[model samples]
Target: MTDLPQELRLVTAIPGPKSQALAARKAAAVADGVGTTLSVYAAAAGGGVVVDVDGNSLIDLGSGIAVTTVGNSAPRVVDAVTAQVAAFTHTCFMVTPYDGYVEVAEALNRLTPGDHEKRTALFNSGAEAVENAVKIARAHTKRQAVVAFDHAYHGRTNLTMALTAKSMPYKSGFGPFAPETYRVPASYPYRDGGVSGPEAARTAIDLIEKQVGAGNLAAVIIEPIQGEGGFVEPAPGFLPALVAWCRENGVVFIADEVQTGFARTGDLFACDHEGIVPDLIVTAKGIAGGLPLSAVTGTAEIMNAAHVGGLGGTYGGNPLACAAALAAIETIEADGLVARAREIGELALGRLRKAQESDPRIGDVRGRGGMVAVELVKDAAGTPDPELTKQVAAAAHLRGVIVLTCGTYGNVLRLLPPLSISDELLTTGLEVLESVLAETRA
Candidate 1:
């Protein structure tokens, strides 16, 4: 474990002199494009707080952008990784296959939703999993066109950048992206004039049929609960409708559960919430308990469509990552984290909803399980309040809390606390947010 006391403690200021020094060094050494949300350099992290180099333990609400779902340095993950490291670090799966990789594949196929005969392939990142999923879909369907939803975040790779929606940080100047990719409206209830799920689905379907006909479409990918897109949960009936359409149209429905997989969304996967099984599912982030591992799990037929030489990479399914994934999955099941995520949602959503009632600036509170967020607005008109969101999050960070802001407008305050966090720590984090939000003016 990244060992330290579990409770939040402040020995020095948030970004104390030591952290400031490191920040200066980082500025000189690291690329300017690589951004940092929190200025404090992490010394260790476990349970609910990240102990900074300055000896201040700050509450961690982002969970490394939902990567450390089982909590950073979880005992099982640490032990498994330690063992695998001692055994052997890398041999390249493409050259010499390993048992850890096969074991992880078996686990993903069995644990992921759906009882159909499935296959699994491992990758090093969510973007690779996604790219491969697209490749598999295209090969199987013998089609070229693929569809992604608005506000979706696939990855930073050229092909994925085309699939992703937001423009600024994720897809600004990196143009000449891969071709034959399209975007459709997602069922965002708050933003879509409160459109019902079925209606929203119909609108998107109509657009797809007209702009990118099903005859040419290879896949339709979506995040059951969007991650970078403000943690937006699609309205009920939306996912199922899309799945049915995709099935009828001979199109592969890909669920990008990269950030919503494993126990982060109250269920093992966000797709489980709606009982919507995708033709292919992309997972990462929480999969390895912070170790870099991702996977594409789907029906055997579609997966096999890819020629043997088509998929896989050098570091795909590294032994240490595979070991960590297995242990992390074991921890999730044994600790009843799925139910714990539900409990967290109840607590956080309740508190945030109460805050919304009191503060008009809080435009909306949405999400399920441990993945909850509040949308900041300038007025009752629901105008985005990016500045207020920034101030509130900065205030929280300065006062020893680590919250993150997201959404296309940067008006969302997303909270992804570790499931292992204590009620007291979680409650205190909420209270800190409430205080910061309350103290705000203009």
Candidate 2:
């Protein structure tokens, strides 16, 4: 709808004069704590290109951190939101219940993993969904402790901050965080040095048993394909073992699918990859095509444990967001984005692996579907290389490609291109990435 071209076209420098000027104004008007990855301001975005105010079209590989899986300004989402806005904006689902809200809940319940009877509750963000999942778990099991894994990034809220592992930006000085949260080791096959999945699970279980105790644990929350934790795919059998352990111990297993849900990981939910059915699934990001919406879907009995009216927010399931989510869901299903994601993953991973063959600095290449990443290292000894990661990302940005970095050691380059991105554009972005990596390494 915006008349911008779909290709990466650099008419000026990455952060051109207009963007630099706007950045100055932003510094004056916006809080310094609210950081940005790219300094360029978006005028329009769709498909795989983000047209900045300077008329430079940057190939979008991040997809707003995996939020626009259907692509920015998706036709279905735009149409749905337009119609919903024309009809009515919001009446607060809690105050004046609407069909859109119920419809979204139905969709989430039906879509999330598990054939057993389930229920869904809407929230405004991923953090809220995670928080509510913990509350429900505690209420149902009458337990006080929750287990989070190392390198996990739940959210920025007080409780989620406690769950999140990163310390610099997300958790520094943000405490005193909520209590009763414990950290356990996550299965990082690359870093675990031949540790079997079962062994990793046992190590984590031993820590939990010794420190937290099963009776005091209400939930064990994790990202199936750890998101901010460097897209670390646990070793085979890791998740299922944890799920079984939680079930046997009467602790709710919550899959924080906030970044991995909705086909981003080639599965509707990442937990589906291993056929691990969690007691609760927290979803957001890709659920609503850029709309602020999140959900906690779980077994009906566990979700119902919360007292009536114990959960909800003023804008939790805003009608417009519900409409957008429904449309996004339809787009994912009808367009076969799940299979498309796998295709994208194959393309990306193939490129990265080929690059890795020549570059020993690429420590590991891991991920599922569209969510893929390569960890950078300093040498054959495999020391994390954060500086090289930053330099490569900067190089990519200068070349009109949007890239993002992540990892516990800040030495990862993640690729989360939109499923709708064209092969031509996707190839171009990856080419830019390859060139950048080669240049940075040299």
Q: How high is the lDDT of residue 270 in model 2?
A: 92
What would the TM-scores of all predictions be? 0.99, 0.99
Consecutive 10-residue window with the lowest summed lDDT within model 1: 1-10
RMSD, one per candidate, in order? 1.0, 0.9
The lDDT, on a scale of 0 to 1, for candidate 2 is: 0.94
**Model 2 TM-score (2 dp):** 0.99
lDDT of 2 by residue, 54-91 (tens): 99999999999999999999999999999999999999
Name the lDDT value of residue 151 in candidate 1.
Answer: 93
Off-target runs (Cα >4 Å) in candidate 1 are: 1-3
TM-score of 1: 0.99
Give the number of the best model, judged by lDDT.
2
lDDT of 1 at 132: 96
